[model samples]
Target: MTLRRLPDLTWEDVGALDLDRTVAILPVGATEAHGPHLPLDTDVTIAAAMAEAGGRRLSAHGLEAVLLDALQYTPAAFAASFPGTISIGGATLAALLTDLAASVQRAGIPTLAIANAHFDPTHLRALHTAVSAINAGGVLRAVFPDVTRRPWGGRLTAEFRSGACHAGQYEGSIVLARSPERVRGEVMRELDDNPVSLSAAIAEGAQDFVAAGGPQAYFGSPAAATAEEGHATIETLGDILSEAVIDALGTETWPRTKEQT
Candidate 1:
């Protein structure tokens, strides 16, 4: 009865849940280098945590949250130089997402909510393409809050707004909050705040992190990241996901009688 992850559940386990109130929560991120101090699955970890928190929020509203397997392979052209970074072509990523969306539709899930932590330009484009393709099929639709935009973006940390948060304090802090043991504190202490905006560099035709003035594959102040901030950021991210999904589903108030699990 405590099951939240779809991949961990049997067919009958899912069937026992109220089908009408179930929502699929897909955590999307890239398998790429975060920095010397952070882990390669940093983005994936953040996405999964955010989605899980959103799932809990949904549960509080009397809905069943079905957590989908996190998609870790995403388009990471910019971080290609890192040893641990693995990236797929944008088209390949797009097709994969499109197929998944279609499968969700065929399975009778009217809506799929994606909680993405990686916001690579190519990845965003691919997601947009997949959403378009799925909507065109008229079966189901994929909704991504795209926290990079407006109001939601503003709600995040200032480092995120700077757009050079690759493995910096913003990211490192989140990892610290989730799993402090994984962080290499020595390396993190050695790294300082990289003020260069990788976003701006990319706009100026820099295709990779080195060209973006992040030669070490990191930006922003890793030394400044704290677990407190990391937890706060996760909470903010969860709010973004919850609001986006709720708005997309057209839920005006609490969907049903509150159900605690």
Candidate 2:
């Protein structure tokens, strides 16, 4: 069966689905500079890829899931100094998520899974608040956050943990794997020596990294990235997210009871 995409799904199409077995997957990503090798929309691109992969996997099992257009360009305060880094601030991001959740709920989707690739603390917090509010009001039946923490997250590991987690070998490899035509090999070579250690920088909260502080805006060694690793990461994430969707949908309940006032 062909899976439905959010942008292409019509009201009639939505009405035909088994509501209990369907999930709405929202791909949330950031538009920031990913060094020299990857595109500015690396986070958004990866999130979309993950969502699509997960949706396909779920669809094969008689469970339906659709990938929503990624909410690209999140609040990246730490990387704001870098060129091509576009942010909307914490308040705006929170409001956007809330509105999106509200719309999904109003459309009768019982479960909403936010597949986010960007690991900004503020964005995560905003997502949590938005999802919590929607679920608490009984508008959304359930919400799943940080789908990456699942077992499938392990597949992203490589010689460089920074690459797998941020704009490094992992992301560059995935981009090359999924969309090789877009990878800029020349730029990757030019910025090969300016890789940043995301964990250390964030832990220290210091603005003294070579990428963010110096010439480049990347945090990992894209030189180590390969198309093979990217494919494996995508496949693993797909499996994890598919299972998550099934579990989430199964746990969904209806007829919310009113609290005693």
TM-scores of the candidates in the order shown: 0.94, 0.85
Per-residue C-alpha lDDT of model 1 across residues 188-228, encoded as one tens digit per residue: 99887799988788778998898888888898999898999
Query: Whole-model lDDT for model 2 versus the true structure?
Result: 0.70
**True-vs-predicted CA distance for residue 49, candidate 2, Å:** 0.7
Clashing pairs in 1: none
Most TM-score-accurate candidate: 1
* Candidate 2 segments whose C-alpha is farther than 4 A from its true place: 145-152, 159-165, 193-196, 207-215, 251-261
Candidate 2 lDDT by residue in tens digits, 1-261:
456787897888888878766788888888877766678888888888888888887667666687777889787765677787888878788787778877877777777877778876677777777777777886575455464344444445643444324666778878888888888887775655444556566566654335334346666676777889888878866766766666655533322124211
